[model samples]
Target: MPSAAGTLDWLPLADHLDLVAAPVASAAALVPRARVARIDAGLADTAAFCAAYDVAPGASANCVVVAGRRGGATTYAAVLVLATTRADVNGVVRTELDARKCSFAAHDDAVGLTGMEFGGITPVGLPEGWPVLVDEAVVAAGDVVVGSGLRSSKLLLPAADLLRLPGARALALSRPA
Candidate 1:
């Protein structure tokens, strides 16, 4: 598989990610040419990771978990937006989730539910009931880098493949950062 640089040793995502994320990553890998790269956990955050690896910020994606509540019922979603944009949680996302209010998921709740570290949450391994809301811009970026469910690795795959994952839906769900 093609990689950003020889610095990233491309490998099957299932081989490098945590148990909770492995199966999903493995499934995503079935898309032709998908690749994953192991990196320092300390650099998992988008800005640092992109800079350290010489990756363009515009080509990297961020997955953020959000929670919404309505009539005492809570709903969760995973939003995928390019690094250059921010998910429209208060507007588009709230409407899509049919919730009265929406906000980023709490760190503890996110980690506990996803079984992944704070900085490495990705849509690939999310719970079955949660929706994966992907920004239309992400799909147009071609190959993009995303979290691997562990702070120590990142998945690199075509944005088109991401849109194909189960529960994924594309929308104009982002605004400039």
Candidate 2:
């Protein structure tokens, strides 16, 4: 239950939901029941997350932030993909952001924008302004793990809930990486 800041305070996902300004509905609103657990290891990096959580690479989902141009202005969006495959940021995400140039947002920027610590970031509970791009593979999955509005824990929810997250669905935004 330790935090990235090395604080002793630890709260469960259920407890932190009240602290979030966004929605707190269950994954059943979109998909079926799935297992949820609290993680104690640091998920600051993909390899570390997978190893610490014992998450199968093929069964895991990765959420990333992509910066691009939208409506002739620079913008950023979150993209979700299976851990087994990389996000197609430069291809579809570039066009989605409507930018001639696009790339991953800086680490600090991504964490600040999403309001969640790195490695624990999921498509859900993001600020309203940021769009979410979901890979089709994720949607096909029955269940997935996402952020619980905190960095120390993750929620196992239906992939369909990912679609329910604001701006989560946008066709052709993903491709084999």
Candidate 3:
């Protein structure tokens, strides 16, 4: 297991359920290697969290919700990219989701549909059938910090482990920020 750096005290997620969101807590069984750390909710946003925790921006990953529409059907997906890059939402993502249009999901829709806070929507417990589009760079990053489905906590684990999550797919899905 990777050790936590900076000022945070990381604890096994299974033993620290109260710090995470309901969905993340319920999914703890699926993440034996992950550790969770409580943080000031006010710093949950990526940039603030990284700076406050003394973490490198490239070693943090962000999960974004995308809404893709084609005809009368709409599809939702999770797009994960390193903090140093941005998801190719209009090009790669639209093509991958097989939608005529794709963009970041509305804030309310993302929170309502995923049952997670706007800035803390991790990919671990996403709804079934929602594709998890992981950027290849994220997969290559051995260990990284990610949201814990709540603004008050964060998750730390080997990036490669994300592939075990349901609907996960590795692809070149990001461009430089």
Model 3, span 1-177: residue lDDT tens = 223344688999889988888988887787789999989999999888988988778889999999999999999999999999999999999999999999999999999999999999999888888999999999898888889999999999899989888899999989999
Judging by TM-score against the true structure, name the best candidate. 3
RMSD of each: 2.9, 6.4, 2.1
Worst 10 residues of 3 by lDDT: 1-10
Model 1 C-alpha RMSD to native: 2.9
Q: Model 2 residue 116 lDDT?
A: 68
By summed lDDT, the worst window of 10 consecutive residues in model 2 runs over 1-10
Give TM-scores for every candidate, taking all chains together and pairing residue i with residue i: 0.89, 0.74, 0.96
For model 3, which pairs clash?
none
The window of 10 residues in a row where model 1 has the poorest summed lDDT is 14-23
Sorted on lDDT, best first, the list reads: 3, 1, 2
